[model samples]
Target: MAEPTERDPLIQKPTVFTDADSASRGEPATKQRLGPLEISASNRRGILAGIWLGTFLGVLTLVPTMMPSISSEFQKFHLASWLGTAYLLATCTFTPLYGRLSNVMGRRGANHTAIAFTAIGTVMCGLSRNMESLIAARFIAGIGGGGLFTTATIIVSDMYTLRNRGLVHGVASCFNGLGMGLGGPFGGLITDLLGWRAAFLLQIPLFVFALILIQYNIRYVTPGKSKGTMEMLKRIDYLGSLTLLVALGSPLFFLSARYNESLPWSEARVITPLILAIVFILGFLGVELFLAKEPVLAPGMLQQKVPVLVGASNFLVGACNFSVTYFYPMWFQVVMLQSASTAGMHLMPNSVSMSIGSLFAGWMMHSTGRYKRINLIFGIFPFIGTTLISRLREDSGPIHSWLSIIPLGFGNAVALHTMLIALLAHLPESHMAVGTGFAQLFRGIGQVLGVAISSAIFQSRLDAELRKRFHVPDAENLIRQIRRNSNYIRELPSEQQAYARDSYALALKTVYIFAACLTISAYLVRLPIPDQDLDKAHARQRAQAEARRNSTAEVATTNAVASTSTGSGLPTPEYPARSPTETETEPEEPAA
Candidate 1:
């Protein structure tokens, strides 16, 4: 057999098999496939990661569809809003923790832990008797769901080199889009047929299946393993974690409480938490940068230009993506007078286009090994889509709404997945998990912010419109009724119904316009991203790592040889050391 070289496809790359080597050995390449699929090992891992990503996102997306059903059953419309808020809050809070934990405990252990939390939370949600209980359960599920998303991305980074990660991320994103797209329709269907509880209960088995697949097939690379439980516990940055929790939790509470309760921003419920959140954010930065030996978010990572810019862009993209995700269904339900199931079906176009966009971006990156230009080009779609969406009226046809969503969905998927690949490409392997986690954290924060801002805009506009249009003494009561139950608007007289629909349509337009501006800002920030060949970068990284290992081995071998010679009573040969000038002169003489 020939000696292996770095350029030899079969030698350096462990994730896939090359046909050239297979032909020489009279065997088939890519023989060790994933289940029944005829693909490489790396591709299989990508598929698994996608399944995990999609499942987590699917379960999270179920809450929006379930809101109406929950309100109808529990008679607490206020608490219904918390279903999504609670989940998002928990997700944002625990994402960083999961990232740090994955670094310490290994990806498999952290992943399994997340799956268990999700399953338990799902069961709790299914069995809950009240809205509060369900909210609490959703919070638990959010923790797990967030972990699944962060770790799944990290696992893809671990399994594939930079060159291949674009496609892998794209594949995973497609599943994410699929899960999100299906979640609404599926939740509504299950809710209508069996009940809303069935929606949560049905997910338990699927979680189990995902858990089993990951346990058996997914490979993990664990970093910072400790010898004992106590040591591991000691390694955790407790203060940093607490500060991060407060920093994230307080702001989320402030926004959610203000919007969900219709309180002024100056109210105690809003201002107190907002102030505390600010304080904790400062504390978090201080502890991470100056105090903690092992920071939850490393200060060094914050300093890196690429990671910082990419993370910021991730935040903006998240805001745009999730704003559309949460609001469009409401538009379909309220403005278009569609049922929850029908609204979900209307969202199918966005989901399908998003999947197509993700796959397209991935293929382009894999083939061209370029993303900056692609990102710049695709980044325009969101602005265009949102601008078009902003023009929607109450009487707009399905074709108009659906067509507008396609660009937003496609633009979001392409930008999001591609930026993730770009992020992983720029960071070192050791920091990949943390970087991915922070990206998710920012995205979650964006989702929470998007919902809060949009909700506030929608509710305030609706209230003003109702007051202006209805000059009766019971107008306030009617507005309250409509706010509490969307069905109330449908029950109103034709003129009132049109007025209410127009109000919602106008509010949505503002939200879409805001999202468009946010998307454009993301495009501007993303311009500074460094475009490098992912394959070449990974190859260099591998070479450096191998060189280090070889140097260490050589040192050990030399030391062992010296020890053996001494033990055997052999004379150690010594040579006179030459000066630097002598060495230089000798080389010059040889050349002469």
Candidate 2:
């Protein structure tokens, strides 16, 4: 009988051996450095699959555990924010660490470490006794969660021809969104109905499910080489890692508490963390240039054309997204006078739109694999949408009001996912983590400012407008007071509420305008991406590297055969290759 074809799954590429070949060779899954790329087709599949799976698994694990009904019984909003932030910083922090670790342990071990992180963190979060304990537990979860988005993306480069990546990205993101939507609502309900601790328990089943899938579908990962371990270690910038941890994690930590406490903005509570971040960042940069054997998150990586320019564009997109996500609900709550539930319902359109946008990008990417142009085109849509959305007046009808946001949402989904996918296309296989990691890092940094900038725009305008319309003696004071809490707003008369809402609307308009501007800046970067069929291009590079290896081996075989197989001093074969013009480009210091 004829064998079944490889087309069983819509996105799965055809494979000749199902990585069964690795099992037969009895190759120890130990690390082997082969130029820049690692070898282990099956392991990469599991790792990649797990990364995508973990993104959903790791994130949603928080859902069923939310304690909306009993904040005292579970955790408060501040504590919950830690869960999400910890995950974000953890993912960012681990990217370089994983890249280096991939070199040391091979992809299989590095990938599995991520799973272990998720399992342990989930348990700790579920069992936490206080807010601080939960925060610590979630930080651990972040280490695992970091692997979810970063490494899965790296595997796309490691495992497939460039032609196939768009399809894979689609499948990966679709699952990610599905997990988020399901994780957020269902988890919330579980916490609301059962208990907050129940949310963390949700991950228990997901971890088991992932294990089953990992066993069934994957068995191996790309392994690094054995040479230069000591030399590489010496170059390792240990201080750089510390600096990065502080530079990023510290600032966000401060921002989380920025609004919670009253401050001079110059006090040590704020100044201390900020100072630490600056010092470390400078120290990290210095070590990267002069001291380390191998710098983590190299400056060259971020400064290059693809990584920096593209990353900057994404930062803008991130800024817009971060702003919109924070303020939209606020508009509904304060202006529309809706409860949290109703505000969420208002947000459903954009959320659902993002999900659909992700699916659409996936399908289009898979069918055509010519996604670069579409990436650019769709990016503009959100920019325009946001621009239009920002123009809505105080009296704008609901139908006309939100239509602009739909386009921006579509634009947003495509811009971020597409740009992220685009990073791998331009970068070498070696620097995939660096490329994706720093882009996301910039985005994270941008998000912090996005909120601040958007808030400042909204609140400042609101203050001026309130003063103009109502002649309030302390409009600026009112804004500062309200930001601390809403209790003060409730004291105002009905006419005051109406006037404040208009001022709030004006503030929101300016913020949305800022969002649109950020989105537009992304377009300039996309125009210069030098779109090659990256999956195919990268595959060509690897295939060429393999050919060189085989040629070297063949010469060794010929010499041995010609020498009558008697020489005790037989040497490893030299690599064979085409002439310089014909040879494939080995990625230089800066891969992008």
- Residue 12 in model 1: shift from native, Å? 30
lDDT of each: 0.69, 0.59
Highest TM-score against the true fold, candidate? 1
Per-residue error for 566 in candidate 2, Å, reads 13
- Location of the lowest summed lDDT over 10 successive residues in candidate 2: 577-586
lDDT of 1 at 555: 58
TM-score of 1: 0.83
lDDT tens per residue, model 1, 491-546: 89998888777777777777787888888998888888888887876777667545
Cα RMSDs, all models: 10.7, 9.4
Regions of model 2 farther than 4 Å from truth: 1-51, 59-84, 122-134, 180-184, 195-197, 221-224, 227-238, 253-262, 363-369, 388-404, 447-511, 534-539, 547-592
Write down the worst ten-residue block by lDDT for model 1: 583-592
| TM-score for each of the candidates | 0.83, 0.73
- In candidate 1, which residue pairs clash? none
lDDT of 2 by residue, 1-592 (tens): 1332444222222111112122223222233223212445655566566567766775453321242222334425323344445555665566556555544434445566777797888899778887778768877877777565555666565566665666667677666555544554565456546666766776687777676555454433342222233443454457776777678766665554444333447777777777777887788778777776566656776566777777787778767876776566556656665443444444556656777787787667667665677877787887877877777765668886656567777777777776776676666554665566667666655654676456556555665676677656776566555443332445678887777777777777788888878888877767777666654766665675567546644664465454432344332222121111111111122322
